[model samples]
Target: MDPKETYSPLNCPKPVAEGIWIFDGLMIRMDLGPFKIPFPTRMTVVRLGDGTLWIHSPIAPDEDLFSAVDALGSVRHVIAPNSIHYWYMADWLERYPGARSYAVPDLATTAKRPFRIDHPLMDGARFAWESEIDWILVPGTKVSEAVFHVPSARTVILVDLIENFEAAKLSSPLMRFMLKLVGGLDPNGMAPLDLRMTFRPKRKQVRERLQRVVDWQPEKVIMAHGRIYDRDGAQELRRAFRWAI
Candidate 1:
């Protein structure tokens, strides 16, 4: 269905469902120490019943983007689903003065932060988002990605539990090769090899979480990086996690 079209013109919010939107941001490179890999940045924005907005994994917000989001609703809650995705909370925190910040329990312990987490709980809900979104935390990974489902939209929001990098979009041969080597390519993308191995020890836990997502039966799966799944989401969930669960 040409999923890349869903994330075009990067840096703008594209509607994914009724109250949900996915913002495609810039291409950022991450250093793996041995080498750097290019990652397409993305984030999700959901408007609450109170007309306030909840931003999942904040990207670098520009003035135009800020104005567009303001038109949608006020940014009241900013969340970092995992340690790797928490880097930009400082920006959203400063932009939305009273917005509460959320993240994994171990985030502030290691990942350097210029900000503080008002809620360090990713499993429980102390806010209104719970009524709309259901989430399961994937254990045994460095990222500790929290996968969420928006029942109203029949959609699942994922940060990095599965990555489907398109070969055509990847410019570097080495990067393409690395992704292919780690089974990060499209049509078969799931957790990378390293994450699969980490999850091996906790396959039962990962299986339980994966089963919950499949049970949601989403119409689409939105990821922070790589092409998204817009159909057969339940079947895709099983295929994607076959390595772990």
Candidate 2:
């Protein structure tokens, strides 16, 4: 799907599953001091049994987006699934002051900006929607990304752990070159080569964690970047992590 066409700040929330909705936001130009490039990003919203919402990897919220979310349910939890994804936490917090914010433990020390983390996400931690949702921390990387599973929808939610960029969608040659170098370009793009290297000595642990996800047999996989895997998700996941496993 073309992110520009599908996700807009002015567009309404798109339903991905029964209780799950997704919002496509503007492409983020990742700036690393000397290096800068744009990458598409997305956010997910999950409504729990109590009618509370869980905002994951939130995008920049505007008045319209906020109003749309409010119509669904009260925002109860804002989750920064990983370190890099926490930049928008402050924005969400300001909008939903009553909502609790949660982030991976590493973000508390690694993140440069200030944000309140009501709770640190732990391995195998359970939530109010435990019966329908499950989560796991993909260990061994500099950033331990938390992957969530919605059993009811047979969907798996990911942050930066896996990416699938389409070359045509990249507007800049530099961005395309960078994505190619990191193996982010589809159709077989998996974890970046550098990220895979970070798992050295702990590849076994990382592989084990991925195995659990594979066993879930997801029918769809939603990621922060690239196209969402709606068919053969389980096979695609295994292929994406082949280097690590």
Candidate 3:
């Protein structure tokens, strides 16, 4: 059976802000040596002022997803916000051949598969949407993740930096146990414990960067995994990073 035939839209992209739409992508299962379970993922679509779409963390592309995106504008930029988020980048590139692909710095070396990277995303790098979107590199982690802030919407887009997994979403007992041990279960999910440990030596630097995020005064916070904070985003962000900060 063809895998594409099995592809079905999980959550169609819906507007969260004026120019931003988010959708829950298909669940991805991971084998963490001793455990295996399907985990939900998401994709964010931002329609720039110029009517071009900026895709963040590309997910499985299907007719429904493409139709929704096409109704907005041409897909012009594909962004891999972190090294681990490059899974579906090649597919997006194939769909939007003209779109410029940007990956977080050092992704070429860390990515599990090959994809065309037009340029490396750097802190404060300027783009066509620079006036509206600002990006910063979250420091002190094994994976380089870039956090983006859209001034127009007063929103922040995060990848793996902060994950909020609900208990009900865990299908396996082992998965629940592991998530509980790492503090990834519902109600208080923040960054994973192991990922936070990576910030030990660079905690200070990471805090400074997070402080800048706080300074943005974001109203909405979107994470690749888990529920989005539609209100008090800044406060939630501070709480999420309290350990590292």
Against the true structure, whose lDDT is highest? 2
**Residue 7, candidate 1: how far off, in angstroms?**
4.8
For every model in order, what is the number of clashing pairs? 0, 0, 0
Query: Candidate 2 on 76-192: residue-level lDDT in tens?
Result: 999999868888899999988999988898888888887998888886566666686788887665867888999888989988778887777876677778778878788877877
Tens-digit lDDT track of model 3 for 1-245: 22231223465867889989987777777666676656678889999888999999988788888887788899999999986889889998998899999988888887888899997888656777677788888766587678899998999999878887766666567777887788656556687877777767787788888889888999999988777788888888888878866
TM-score of each: 0.92, 0.91, 0.91
lDDT of each: 0.81, 0.82, 0.81
- Candidate 1 — which residues are off by over 4 angstroms? 1-7, 122-125
- C-alpha RMSD (angstroms) for model 1: 3.1
Any runs in candidate 3 off by more than 4 Å, and if so which? Answer: 1-11
